[model samples]
Target chain A: MTPMTLADAANLHTFVDALRFIGDHPGFLAQKALEQLELSGAALGIAIAVALPLGVVLGHFHRGSGVAIGASIVGRALPSLVLIAAFLTLLGIGFVNNMVALAVLGSGPILTNSYDGVDRVDNEIAESARGMGMTGWQIVRRIELPLAIPLLFTGIRIAAVTIVATAPIAAIAGGGGLGDVIVNQASYRLSGVLGASLCVMALSALVFVALAGIQIGVTPRGLRGTTVVHDHSRKEQQ
Target chain B: MQSHWGDTLQPALVQHIELTAIAVVLGFAIAFPLALLAHRYRKLEHPIGVFSALLYTIPSLALFQLLIPFTGLTWTTVEVALVAYTLVILFPNIVAGLHSAPDEVLEAARGMGLTRMQTLTQVELPLAIPAIVGGLRVAVVSTVAIATIAAFLLPDGLGYPIVLALKEPTPFKTEIYSAGALAISFALLCDLALVALRRALAPWAARGLA
Candidate 1:
């Protein structure tokens, strides 16, 4: 084995120290994790409430594909740091302000995916449903929605992971989460920063995995392996 | 307004572009080979995709903080995270693009007496340009947006002005709006450039689509 350098030893010490910090501050970490979940969960709820209906309606009509895609492009480009700062003048600081900005941040994928999901359902299927005397809403409710669930849930998963990951930025905006420990490294030290980062990472992964399970569970049995989840519109979630 | 543009916005824009460009290029350099490797070896594809996706699921801020212990608060930490972000976006697109080259086309290239290297370099890669560029556009735009977070570590990029403005007793509205607008515009501009580049690179493909 190669001899370890002083830097390597220091790095090892830092890692162990961070682990110790996490072990010692379970309550603090849990509280921050809860804050993160609540903030992200609220934001995601808002995003789904606003974007899903609009997407579904537009997609049902096969109109406003431009609007859906455009939202995603703009959303992907909008920096959370800048967005929270810009909203500072209007919304002021705190959980509501950050929650609103994060909702806006999370809305894009939900809108785009929901639209793509409904719109991409087979024309034949829709027409056949129409032939069977199904109304527009009925077709949407019964056929289109069932078919669209897989992709729509994929959008929510993307948004959930993104919101969870981004929830930390709320700390910078005075909306406390795990980021409080992360940004206050002067007080918490490097160990705390690293520990908080680990917590945040774990929290995001938990959100992602949980949502993925929910997605799998909710997807129509017929659509499980058939839906093409990857496409150009679905890019980097982070 | 003029003074702010001269003293702050201009420098911030340059730094943002530089930071974004470096991260995307570095990401491509690392991801391209890995994508090619994964494409050639089918067994590696799932693992590589999962690994990159795992990196991407971590929020940008947390990723930067995670690197603080190892790399300190330098731009390297930011770059590493930014590059990692691009991998998840780039790898799948490149691998998909590679697989997109039809077997008929490969057979034709082989029939023309082209070596495996020649077939890949001359035939397959040219066809993959559109998909590769599509990935680049996403990576570049996302990187441009995420690179702003580098300001939390260093006083550079458009994020610097936003952070600075936030630090004020009353946030500087002009600074925040200007920086935010610049970052969005920069991302859009890069995206438009990539679209134009794709059209230029694969005119035949564009024509086919048209």
Candidate 2:
């Protein structure tokens, strides 16, 4: 139990001050975080809405899959900053512009993975579905989408991570979010910046973990059974 | 054509190309051998890969701040960050490419009396070239885009025009958008060049295209 040094006391004072600042500004931080959450959520929604349908359609019509692939490549190649600026020009900066930019970024992974997943589905199963007089939509809904779901989810997981990570850039362009807190507060209050950045990191990690959990949970047991059955049949054939 | 937007575009485009080319070439020059060394040493690979990954994960602005004490406000800071980013995308790729050479191919080359260097150059490197080139493409595009963000610290590149526009009144917003579009188009062109280069260098990988 030696006496505290001056350096130690100063360190303690800084730490206590940081804690007090956070305590006093809880609403500010929460509001910022909520804005980020809302923007991300909307972006994710729009991404899934557009990407899934486009992916499935392009995958089904495999004759011209290059179009979708080309689009995804363009999307991926375009910088998120550029996309944000483009949206800002058209929609003006705010929640809607941020949402559009993020959605465009998010679309690439989801669309590409979805196309790959559905394209890789067992062709024989699709032929069999057609042989049974099933419609194209039925074949997709029953056979293709189900089999492709896991890979589709993997794409979504990637998109989710990208959106969460890049969402902070929105703050720079006047879209309010955790990034605003980090960028603005960091100029004066280093502790606030650190706190906001930590929150962002935690949020990204949480989103990734949650998506992983959802993937594990939603994969149907019957699909595993079917995979096992296919393997068994292949072994017997050999 | 006589507007302020036009005034900003011409100089900004030149600066944009100059900065991007310098950063990309420098980053690749640094990344290639570092990747090779990391791949050669089993003990060094994981740690180096993880370190590069961690550096990449740190936000650009944070990395800038971290480097400020040593680099001050110079382009050196931005160059360091760009190079660090290239390593994250390039190292794993080179390692994977080297490892992708079939083990049997190496053994056969050795059995045929080829030395280690001979085996690497003749057998492993050719096989790895496609993947290495692919990684380079990714690295180049990523660095080009990220380099724009560096303009906040340094007064150069297409980002200068965009930042200037941001500071101006409402009527000048189009200048920002146009400059940004130009930047994106430049990235897109670089991406296309990489794809074409990859296909040209690795013709086998490009088979089935009419």
Candidate 3:
């Protein structure tokens, strides 16, 4: 199907129609949103569970070992499409498969940020904690983990936004998401595409805000302002 | 269809590469200037950075569809989203890399009577290679990945085979796997090449004693 023209996209009727369509079938759009959210949440949850610990442990050891860097780099660089497509071939089509693919794609940022967050903890802080008879676990639990909250959630936030944004592609695997609306241009046409895009973007924005709130909530209020906004996470988005 | 697998897979790979090149090269071209502008004007960084960051968050699918009205399912449409996706990474890297140049080193260049532009070109830029290249590596890899999805916009990409296979009554597993492998392989190849490029561009980075 050919794409919509500028006129169609700009026509006041388009926005009105799209909004009406969304209003008319709130259930369908809501279901799509929930499905997208579920897949995104599952994908990011798996990624954080796996990559977060690995990153935190590697960071706690203060090891800049090649494994840490190599893993994050490769993880960040691997595209979601490749993972999704590859999994589709191997696993056919399933919710579990889509989650794994997204986990693979999202793991890099989590790993990288977690590692960086822990690795960059002030030596004085760790040493002071150690000097006070803190065990390795104690130091990690008290000093490092608290300090790393900003970065840890930053990683999760990046993963969350990315997963939410990319979950639509799950449609190709027979997984439900807004991606179906975008692809089925025949039925939806311009408004469907535009409306779906709006929904997906809204989902992403909601995910980001919700995660950011968590990041801030966990962070010590004083340190909150200083937790650098990791805007460079664009690499993870596609 | 039993014959000439070369004609098919080869072009798909090349087209992916061409798409990557167009997107990255042009992305860098636009990003570098913007980076410089942001660097020169500190106030610009916040707005420009925020804008790019917001743009960055817009999913590739939405962004591509968002442009269909203007670009209309053409290669240009794909490239627009691809390039926009790149800017968020590229701009920050260029500016940060430039800013990351050690003040003393920059002062030393200035002390040697190099003009501002001369200092930037001769000393700062070389010093900035690692970060800039780091950004480039990410940009290239992600662009390659994003371009796979671009097949939904325009044909003749690795994504084409995957999309096509899905449409088949029984989607051929090998076909999907092979295309996926090639796309992943192409991204890795670009990444490795850029690693080598960074090393070649700034040999001092390896030694770390700079």
lDDT of 1 by residue, B61-102 (tens): 888877876788788888888988988899999999888889
Clash list (residue pairs), candidate 3: none
Kept native contacts, as fractions per model, are 0.79, 0.15, 0.51
Number of clashing residue pairs in every model? 0, 0, 0
lDDT of each: 0.87, 0.73, 0.81
Model 2 misplaced regions, further than 4 Å? A1-27, A129-134, A185-195, A219-238, B1-7, B37-72, B169-171, B207-210
lDDT comparing candidate 1 with the true structure:
0.87
Give residue A29's lDDT in candidate 1 (0 to 100): 94
Poorest 10 consecutive residues by lDDT, candidate 1 chain A: A229-238
Off by over 4 Å in 3: A1-16, A227-238, B1-4, B206-210
Tens-place lDDT per residue, model 2, A1-238, is: 9898876676566556556666878898778878888898899999999998889888876645676676666765677766776677778767888899999999988888788778767667888999999999999998888888787888898888778777877776777787786666436475666566656766776787788888878777666423312222442353
Candidate order by decreasing lDDT: 1, 3, 2
Compute each candidate's TM-score over C-alphas. Answer: 0.95, 0.81, 0.90
Error of 1 at B204 (Å): 3.5
| Ten residues in sequence with the least summed lDDT for candidate 2 chain B | B61-70
Using TM-score as the measure, what is the rank order of every candidate, best first?
1, 3, 2
